[model samples]
Target: MKKIVLLLFFLAVIAQTAFAQVKKPTLMVIPADAWCMNNDYMTTYSAQGITMNVPDYKLALQNDIDLLNVITKIGELMAERGFPLKDLSSTIRSLEQSSAENEMLMSATSGASLAETPYEKLMSRAKADILIELVWKINTVGPKRSVTYTLRGLDAYTNKQIAAATGTGAPSISAETPVLLEEAVLSNMDNFASQLQMYFDDLQTNGREVSVEILTFDNGSGVNLESEFDGEMLTDIIDTWMYNHTVEHRYSVSDATENRMLLEQVRIPLFRENGMPMDTRNFVNNLRRDLRKAPYNIECKLLTKGLGKAVLVLGEK
Candidate 1:
């Protein structure tokens, strides 16, 4: 009997390992675009010819404490479904501290500021596989309040909409927005999570989508991607880098040129060594490090266009 019990336990262990191999995508929950726009938590940041309208999560939280609770509650709901979550509030705090450090260590630019939003900075450090966005409204009628919510799960690596859910809560005596939001989500949270999981499974077999581009600076010192490096053009060297670094060697070259290269369909690992998720920036950063080595000693700036595309501006100081 004991031998049979041990066999059962071993089989259970193997089953668990196989399930874990499937992997759950890490998540980052934040206020939805509509909520931010309504609250005016927005800022424009431009760099390297790319511009983005990003949210000020910290500012939104400052304006309303319930916003934090709303995000936290949504995260809790997702967490119950076995997904790991990065706290946007905590990420904002860390960014604030980092910003202070930057101010102390460096001088400010005199021209127009190009400061990115807290959401953008948070996106960089969290490196979550998906970004869960929440938008909720509380309606009061006849002494009862109900919450209507729209939840969306976007691919953190690609900015694609992978899942969406909308629901209305039962009217309750409590007029609290957070409570209403939680109640509304609980009604269909399981289905929402299932849809996200299905999408993640697809991303696992196929690869997460992303785009990569290489461009030479106009003020360059005449050294472009066509320059010879180790008997091969610098463009060829970068192509080799992508082929070697992409997960499972899966990627598609959309276009290539002496001074520009466009690569799409990049396959990247879902997580890093420290358990943080990986994204386009992390993949390009690796290439940047390689290019800084002895033969190619290239100077460049890494800019992200949306969540999925990485731009490496070559020859920019």
Candidate 2:
């Protein structure tokens, strides 16, 4: 009897391990913005009368052989540890091919384009679960050389740094950036992987974090947060929908008024019912579609700024 109990326990443990291995988070490695600027791969982007300098990822990937080597090495290492990887250069190229003409989403009522940062555009295209930003330098001591490296794992949806590793490898005679980087990473990879796993575990338990905002168009439609349907204000109805849809009903209403509603720290599920990845836009679009039905019959426009924030403009598509 004791032998049978032990066998069952071992089988259960093996089953749990297999289950955990099935949904490893996908990761992509890119050079840090600081690294890009230092390497002279910076470009200007303008939005809403605000011009700012951002990393020129395409230029960097095309011109910097060392950057490509470093990214490939990190990707290989992470893949060995069972995490799926996305190639940054490939993603950029794919985006270029798909959007040959600059695609802009404009408001039908106002003729205004959606606001988006350069980084946001990249994130929306890449669609990786975690973004690994890497920055490295070579230290020369007399004739010997060493690598100083930093790796930051950011949650793609929230842009929050979940894990980080930084260190300098022991002085080596090798001058290859990839070789020195591999040495530095080998020393820290285990700890970094453990940290990443912990973050993923938390995500499985708590769901993804995202923000949502409800706005009304100035089209003179009698629809706003103050509008009532079946004796419940539009604000209350949306709040109840959020409560019912979010994972564990975890979300906070930061501000609410007749014109707008802001919801932050919203905990949405990681996947949809059919096992596809779920994002902020999809979640909000679900709400938008529901509101379009019988009792509400609301018309709304859905605009997503990046991976984590979505805006639904009510009272005009």
Candidate topping lDDT: 2
Listed in order, each prediction's TM-score against the native is 0.78, 0.95
What TM-score would you give candidate 2 relative to the actual structure? 0.95
What value of lDDT does candidate 2 attain over all alpha carbons? 0.90
Writing each residue's lDDT as its tens digit, candidate 1 over 83-154 gives 988888787777777876555542233344444445656777677889888888878888998988999999
Per-residue lDDT value at 232 in model 2: 93
Per TM-score, the best of the predicted structures is 2
Instruction: Name model 2 segments beyond 4 Å from true.
Output: 9-13, 101-115
Model 2 C-alpha lDDT per residue in residues 53-101, reported as the tens digit of each score = 9999999988989899999999999998889998998988887775644
Ten-residue stretch with the least lDDT total in model 1: 106-115
The 0-to-1 C-alpha lDDT of every candidate, in the order given, reads 0.81, 0.90
